[model samples]
Each structure stands twice: as C-alpha cells, then as structure tokens.
Target: MIKNIIFDFGDVFINLDKQATYKELAKLGVTEVSEEMMQVYYRYEMGLITTKEFIDFYHKKFNIAKKDLINAWNAILLNFPLHRLEFLKELEKSSKYRLFLLSNTNELHISWIQNDWGNNLYQEFKNCFEQFYLSHEINLRKPNENIYEFVLGENNLLASETIFIDDTKENTDIAKNMGIHVWNINPETEDVVNLLNRKEFL
Candidate 1:
C-alpha cells in the first residue's frame, strides 16, 4: 500500500510548457542555445548559482535586457487550473497518505509563479502538501540519487510505501531504482486527477 505520495509540480500539478523558454528565446533572436547556457541552467537548478548571476549570464550572452531575458526564462510557466488545486486539496483532506511536492525549479520560475498566481493561490496550492521541495531551494534536484535519498531520509518515509509521480521519465526512473513506485505521466495524454481517480485514490 502506498502511504506516501510525491508529485512533481511543473506538469503534474501546475502546467508548464517544457520547450516554451527555448522557443521564446529563439523568437527573441537568440538563434542558438549554447552548451554553456545548458550548463548554466543545470547549475542553476542544482542551486549552485544565484538567480541574479543566471539572469546576468544569459542577458550578456544573448545581448538581451535583463527584464526581457527574465520573461523569456519564465515563459515555460503556464496556468494552474482551479480543478487541479481542488483535487489536490481534496486528496490532502484524506490524511491517509503523506503528500509532498518535488520540483526542479529555479528562482525566476518561482518568482514568476508567485506573481502570476498571487500569494493566496500559491499558498493554497502549497498548503495541500505536507512538504514542498524545490530544487533550487533545497540545493538538490531530481534524477539525482542523493536528492531522492534526502527526501526519504528527511521525511522518514519508506521507499516501498512511497509513490512518486513525475512527467519526466528520467526522474521516475531514478525513483524506481530506489524502490519507490512511480507514475511516469505523459501530460499530452493524461490528466493527473483522472489518473489518481482511476487508481481509486480519490
């Protein structure tokens, strides 16, 4: 029996356009995304670089203003439906399964979410989880063995009793390797609420 559930925020809870940032940058005349930029993004997600530094690096490299670059970087964030929020809230009411949120996100993305959703919505969304873990905030990220270990150890959760749901195959693969059950959801064809409902979780 799954006693704990971990969800990935980006696509599982809130919608995100996986390629929106890159597409937006291309529209802004950043015709090429360099290998260095990819490294920077990785470092940023790992919490190894500051938000200001990340923005500055992109701004200088792309010759774009900081504000515009910020917009491009945040373009991946999309709307969070009220239905999803309500679903999670309902799930939380059960108290049978411990709930956690784990996302590979950075400062700019978080700031954009706050600005877009406002404090109340953001708080309500966050309140649905027992623990909310952001990659940048925690200095660790998914698809990394240590990060998964960190969550399990920190929360005293049993891997066998936990189910991790993520849109990324890599993330789910890593969690499965650690003995955690996983749902590798495909956003294009699946609705998280529906999936859970099918599992009789709702």
Candidate 2:
C-alpha cells in the first residue's frame, strides 16, 4: 500500500513555460548558455551561491543588467491553477497518506511566485504538504540520488510505499530506480486533478 505521496512543484502544481527563460534570454542578447553557466545554474538551484552572486555572475559575464537577468530567470514561471490546490487540500483532508512536496527550484523563481500568488495563497498551498522540500532551501535537488535518499531518510519513508509524481522523466527515472513508484505526467494532456486515474494510490 502506498502510505506516502511525493509531488514535483512545477508542471505538477504550478504551470511553467520551460522554454521561456531561453527565449527571454535570447531576446536580451544572451544567444547561448555555456556549459559552465549551466553548472552555475545547478549550483544556484542547490543554494550553493547567493542570488546576488548569481545575478552578478551573469551581469559580469554577459554584460547584462541584474534586473534583466532576474527577469529572464523568472520567465519560466506561470499560473498555479486553484483547482490543483483544491485537489491537494482534499487529499490532505483525507489523511490517508502523508503528502510531500519535493521541488528542484531556486530562490529567485520562488520569490516571483510569492509575489505573484500573494503570501496568503502561497502559505495555503504550502500548508497542504506534510513536508515541503525546496532545492534552494535544502541545498539538494532532484534527478540526484542523494536528494531522494535525503527525503527517505528524513521522513523514515519506505521507498516501496511511496509514490512520486513528477513531470520530468529524468526525476521519475531516478526515483523509480530507487524502488519508489512513479508517475511521469505529461503536462499538456494530463491534469493533476485527475490523479484518481492513478488508481493504485487510492
């Protein structure tokens, strides 16, 4: 039986335009992101560097303004359908399974969300989860073994009885290899509100 459920934030809860950052950056004269730059982004997501340092790196390297860099960084965020929040709240009410939010996210994007969604709405969404793990806050990220291990160890959750739902195949692949059940949802055709279709969890 599945006693715990883990969910990814972007695409699973809030919508994201995954290509928006690249597009927006291109418009700002950033034609390409080098391999080193990607590594820095990963580190930023892991909270290994401060946000100012992150913006400053791009400001110095690409000659882009800090404000523009911040704007490009946040372009990927979009709406969080209230229906999804309602569904999650319903799940929380059932109390049949422990609910968790595990997201590979950075501080700037989160700040944008807080500003966009308002603190009260953001808090309401967060309150639905028993454990909320943000990559920037925890200094860990998804698609990595240690991150999965951290969650399992911290919560004393059995890999066998936990179901992870994410929109990224890479993330789900790692969790699946760790003996956790997974659903790699397609954001275009799937509604998380239809989680009932994933019958095993019920």
Candidate 3:
C-alpha cells in the first residue's frame, strides 16, 4: 500500500524545456556545455553559490551581459496550466496519500516560477503538497541516495509505503534501490492521472 507520493516538479507537474536554456545559451556563442559549466550549475543547485555569483561566473567567462544570461538560464521554465493545478488539488482532496514535491531546482529558476505563476498560483500549487523540497533550498538533490533518505527520515515515511515519481531514470532507480516504489514517467507519452488510477496503486 503506497501511503506517500513523491513527485518531481519540473515535468511531472509544471512543464520545463530541458534543452531550451542550453539551446538559447548556444545561440549566445556558448556552443558547448562543458563539465566545468555543469559543475557550476550543480553548485548553484546545491545552494553553495549565490545567484549573482552564478550569473557573474558565466558573464565573466562568456563575456555576456547579466540580463541576457539570466533570460537564457530561465528559458526552461515555460508555463503552468490550470488543468495540472486542478488535478493536484483533486489528488489532495482524496487524503489517501501524503504528497510531497521534490525537484532539482535553483534560485533563479524558482524566482522565475514565482514571477511567472504569481503568488496565488504558486500558493495553490504549494497547498497541494504536504512538503515541498527544492534542491537549492534543501541543499540536496535527486539521483543522490542521501536525498531520498533525507526525505524519508525527515518525514518519518516508510520506504516500502512510498511511491516516488520522477521523469529521470537515474532518480527513479536510486529510489527503487532504497525500497521505494517508483514510476519513471515519460511526460511525452504517459499521463500521470492515468497512472494514479491504475489498479495496482489503488
């Protein structure tokens, strides 16, 4: 019996273009995403680097303006539709499972979401979850075993009774290794609402 549900925010609920930001940056002459650039992004997601520092690192390295870089970085966050919001709200009404949100997100991304969705929409989204965990905010990220452990320990949730849903195979695999049930959903093909209705889960 799955008594808890952990959802990945980016594609599971809110839409994100994983390659859009990189494509935009490439247009600005950042033709390749180097390992060092990836490390910078990881550090930023871990909350070890400030937003200004992140922007400055790229700006100084690429000689791009702050605003232009910020726009490029934030291009991945597109929009949140009411249907998804309503689906979550309905899911919450069931009260059969404790819901949590876990996302590998950084400060700039979150700021963009807040601004784009506005406070009311954001609040409605938050209201659907028992706990909302962002990588930068918590200093932990998915695909890392420790993050799943942290959530389980912090919430006193049983691994066997929890279902973790994420778009990334790596994250889902990690959770499965820890005895948590997982749904490695493909947003392009699978519908989450239908997954929830499957007889196995219910």
Tens-digit per-residue lDDT, 117-151, candidate 2: 99999999999999999999999998999999999
Pairs in clash, predicted candidate 1: none
Runs with alpha carbons beyond 4 Å of true place in candidate 1: 198-202
lDDT of each: 0.88, 0.93, 0.90
Model 1, C-alpha of 94: deviation from truth (Å) = 1.0
Quote the RMSD, in angstroms, for model 1. Answer: 1.6
- Candidate closest to the true structure, highest lDDT: 2
Estimated TM-score per prediction?
A: 0.95, 0.98, 0.97
Against the hidden true structure, what lDDT does model 1 obtain? 0.88
Candidate 1's clash total is 0
The 10-residue segment with the lowest total lDDT in model 1: 193-202
Best by TM-score: 2
Which of candidates 1 and 3 is the stronger one according to TM-score?
3
Roughly what TM-score does model 1 have, to 2 decimal places?
A: 0.95
Sort the candidates on TM-score, descending order.
2, 3, 1
